[model samples]
Target: MAEEGISPSRQGRPSMTSSMRSSSFLREHQQYRPPSKPENHYGIDTVVEDLQATSIAPPRQISPFNGIPSPENPPVIVESGVSHELSHPNCTPVPGTTSFDRLVATLFYKSTSPRVSNAIPSPIRIPSPPKRAKSPTPHTESEIPPNMSPSSSLDTFPLEPPTTEPEPLDHLYGSYISPMCITSFLHLMSTFPLPPGSTDLNSAHRCLKLDTAHGHHPLVVELTMAPAPSLDYLSLSDLRKHELIYRFEREWNVDVVLRSDTLWRRYPRLVVFDMDSTLITQEVIDLLAATINDPPDLAARVSDITHRAMLGELEFDSAFRERVKLLTGLPGSIFNELRPVLDVTNGVRPLLRALKRLGVKTAVLSGGFLPLTSWLAGELGLDYAHANEVVIDEATGRLTGEVKGRIVGKERKRELLLEIAKKEGVSLDQVVAVGDGANDLLMMEAAGLGVAWNAKPRVQMEAGARLNGDSLLDLLYLFGFGDEEIRTLTR
Candidate 1:
């Protein structure tokens, strides 16, 4: 007897074949028959056709460096007798525009097409990973799976920038500081007000290298905090923040510029400068006064007025007129002598050169005479030059004690800055003003980044940032330029 659903030959050993028949065999050979049409069937031909139709990608070439092909040495692709190179290592011959390369490239590069801001995530409600109580265990090469490639593992688990659901009043602070100072700095910062739900102070901040330059490339320390509810009733109450920045500067001997971690200030489109005392060591007007020592007391008197005007103690227009009147009989040829003698402030040339290389428009707005301003413009390759023009007697070729055009006073300097920014199609927020006098306050206030360059106490207190470094080239650091970049630009 045979078991149900089992043939007599398969009853004994499961490996027994139909050809090895028992004694009860009905015939030596059995007839062959194919399955009915209703049964499911699979064949080698069907598998090959399905694979061709789907256009399945072949295994990607594993790059020796970081498992991703370098742009310089991309994988070569052959199509229609022409060998084309694909920069994306993961790209394949997909049928439509929905290739992996097309989708991933958008993630890395900016698009010129108009953006739909409505689709963007809320700035304050970004998602972040849960905080870890301890440092993560170090990962070793042996921990990687044997069959998994490096790129595949990266694709499976990608590193992402931190996202947090911070309050609307949360503030961000960025500073260039040395590694040794960070611990002490953070210790001091711990006293600052923190946002609600805050845990560890150490976890609320991060440090990163903003540049790869050798020799004293400061790491950028970013601290995020939200003022206590009692202090956050109004948005513009930043007295404490400014106080902290000032204290930090005085203690560290380095400026800690406060700004959003955004791209706007990093790349300014225009930089306007004050000629006297800012771009140059001496006031051109004072230099002009010294040239005429007929009275011997003339230089001292003029210097007194200039100092008063720069300190905001006197009106610029009156002070300028008083100084120019003393130079009534000075010969026009004096400009020729002073042109070569005028000392440009240290780092002015390199700073201007770097700005020019970056395609930033450079200008000189001077309260001095137009002749000297024009000469400096040509020497330093400034894009625009504006100054008060001292009228010269046509017959005698001497100063006539009269200004020919609109005085480039405080108001006019600001107006000129806007006019130039408009002409160049740059936003006011993309402009930087550098000056040292009270007259420069209006223009500096109007610009996005107002730097008081070795200015008086009044100007330093009111300006956006104060720079007291020995060289004006230190100004580059405010724009996030590292030593390597400064060297390259100056070179």
Candidate 2:
């Protein structure tokens, strides 16, 4: 055994037969130690095979800064995604570390691949978004009150009993209805409640929309009895009853109006409106008050009086006298300076366009000064204008306390409407009147259809129809013009 331990032929080597036996016995007695490396070094090829056999996830590209996946020691991921390896040839293992331990740490602790997060996929189609209306629907049908009682939110007009269906358009009017019937209005044939003699649809006459602010659709008053009348015309009295819509609208802050198809609509030859706060957005008196010395206080006082006067609490004639008296010292040229600043109501231009399209005679009857009214009429292409005349002192060239001629108050306004209607060869029922004051009430009532444009509560209550906003073109809705018709008229 001694000779076998050392080479038998080597003379320099010591014999270690006894030592060899002793070391062997000691190795057999010691506890087991694991290998420093795993039996298989699973690099890219080994990992790819294991991955294919396992879950088969795609290879993840790890950045260099993160541990274990540096430039020299790249991450090992198989295409089939069965397994992975962390150990690299360039990496030196720490004490007690093995391939299995390194693999466990790398697989569990490594950050997600940049390729997965940064990749852009193929484009896919997405549905288009729904379009929205230019103006939101003011209300839904559900919001419209079913009851049309005088006190309810919805006002109703009692329809006369349906009369016998009349003869054809050729038989009634004795001629073909004008081409306007094609482009001027909405449904005038069946829905409109025509008076006794009307056989054909007059598009321009009865074309109107009720206040749409409450809803997208024109205003609809619940009929007292179903099926609106075809025989009777909607008169000033009938128009007044319909004010329940406008009156209750105050509760909702809705701005809209409804014009009835009536005698006035059939023969509408005259369109009359107030000057201040009706045709124009501003009240001439209020604007004039601002022109006075210490205008703030004067404007407040004048506005209060104007408010009271508009409410019918004070006579418009006296109120006009009192209000204008404050303008005694203001230069008459102030009106000219202020004239350019005046803005026509939004509905004014549109309504005027509609009126001109219909060839209706238009007039302005104002309690305000005549220069502004006359200028407005001229600018707006109105045929006539009537207002209180302002007297200028020749020596001082300032406004005098006295107004010339008759003060164009409520009674005068009514007279003017009648006068215009007469000159147009039409009856009082042919006149369409619009205003925003107490003075406008009498004349508004006298006209076939009286419209209150942003008037006082009393005026709104009394007028046939009330528009509760700054837009004047909506008045054409009262004439039954649809959106397309209005657009065409304006164009």
Candidate 3:
């Protein structure tokens, strides 16, 4: 049997084969037996009798062949009239058996035996083993099964999902400190009473404490909160008051308090204008170009480039050079002829008169040729004029296409604002700057108030306030002027 069919178990003992007696025993057990008249039957009977005489059971069938009885055993005999030659040819003896196989065979044989059918027990289903908890120690090479390598085990079971935790509150707060948080903290401090005999208000003390903890100067913190009522009682008798007042003045300048019904009361100061595009509808260069043999496209391109430069996209010098290059050989006489056609912007006369009557010294600061700026300034009765002088070729009387004086870029404009303020004996806070270009950013920054009139988006973002939907005369509203004052000034 050991030399016959292989056992299913990977590890087991060799198989055992019973002698011929076992075959005879099996044949005797069966009701039909071979007939004595057949010689083949006689041979089979002799073999079965010989196996039976040896007192051993027949070997269990393995496959279809090799089911012949052994020659030794003779105690068990075959029945008559059964054919031995007709057994299945493919049967073979079971081989390499183990205790497990023996148990399986016992169950199988008992189930098939007719005599043991009544005694056959019901299948006892073994319960599956409970799962064991994983050990804390990590598995190493020795712990894994023989068929499963480390890589194979890793493929079988993936890593556990990562655990995520919320960011700490301090880290989140450090990343983004809301303005509302500051206001809320101030409000919270206002709820507490001031310490006895302390001149400092509770809110001011809280601010000081916060500043001290954060290593910021107490005076700077006080200066920042000076406008609030919470810090009103703090002494401002020293130069600190002047600083605070200056700060307040700058803040008040940007705020359009004219609509507050307190403009004249809060700030009584001067106003200024830019002649081209600011006070007038026409740009002097475009006006000159429109009178030339040049197409309207030239004027449009110059204006568009000028507009973009003012909004801070291209550099002022670059835009100016590009624009001037387009008008390189044009006659200077074009300026003289187009002067009369320069259109005045809407609300100019009224806004000018309103500012004049309000005792606001009005001026015109222009990047246009002085001739055009001066003519417009005189026509409008403006108090002062500042503009570039256009150079002319001496022999041809044609335009040189170059400015003679300072090119009023942002820095020069800022200088002009400061110079005007100093010469007029007023602080920068007393002056109001209005313009619609990138070159005006410095001037706007210098003045106490900056008004962006129908300005580009960039100018609007940087300017203190914008006037898109309203007339220039609406500037009076910032001074707290009403419709009555407007009418009076115009009249």
In TM-score terms, candidate 1 sits at 0.59
Please write out the lDDT profile of model 1 over residues 19-106, one tens digit for every residue: 7656654444457545455445555465455555564367444323343557644577555599976568556555664411100000
How should the candidates be ordered by lDDT, best one leading?
1, 2, 3
lDDT of 2 by residue, 1-491 (tens): 89787775687767667555654665757698566678765566655555456642476643324445666556775555577776765578677753220000000000111111212233344443356544354333322132222344333443432322222222222122222222211232234464465454322222233334433322321111112334355543553354433332322223333334344554477888888888887888888887766755988999999989888899878888898888778888887998888988876787788789888889888888888888889999999988888899999989887889899987887777777777778777777888888888888889877888778888877777766544677666555445677788888
After superposition, the stretches of candidate 2 with alpha carbons farther than 4 Å from their true spots are 1-267, 294-296
Error of 1 at 264 (Å): 0.5
**Winning model by lDDT:** 1
Residue 134 displacement in candidate 2 (angstroms): 48
lDDT against true structure, model 3: 0.56
Q: List TM-score per model, in order.
A: 0.59, 0.52, 0.47
Model 3, residue 111: displacement in angstroms? Answer: 99
List the candidate 3 regions with Cα displacement exceeding 4 Å: 1-265, 294-297
* lDDT, candidate 3, 1-491, per-residue tens: 86455654534866554553554567758888776566554454566555555644565422222345444332344468543443333355567531111000000001111121122233445443346865566434343333333455567553543232222222223212223333433443344333344444322211211123443412111112212232234321221223332232222121111111122323646677776778887677666655555565887788788777777888886676666667767777666666678778878888888777767788888877777788788889898888877677888877777767567677777888788778888777678888887788778878877778767777766776566533576565555344555677789
Q: Top TM-score: which candidate number?
A: 1
Model 1 regions lying over 4 Å from their true place? 1-180, 194-241
Query: lDDT score, residue 66, model 1?
Result: 41
Query: How does model 2 fare in lDDT?
Result: 0.62
Comparing candidate 1 with candidate 2, which one achieves the higher TM-score? 1
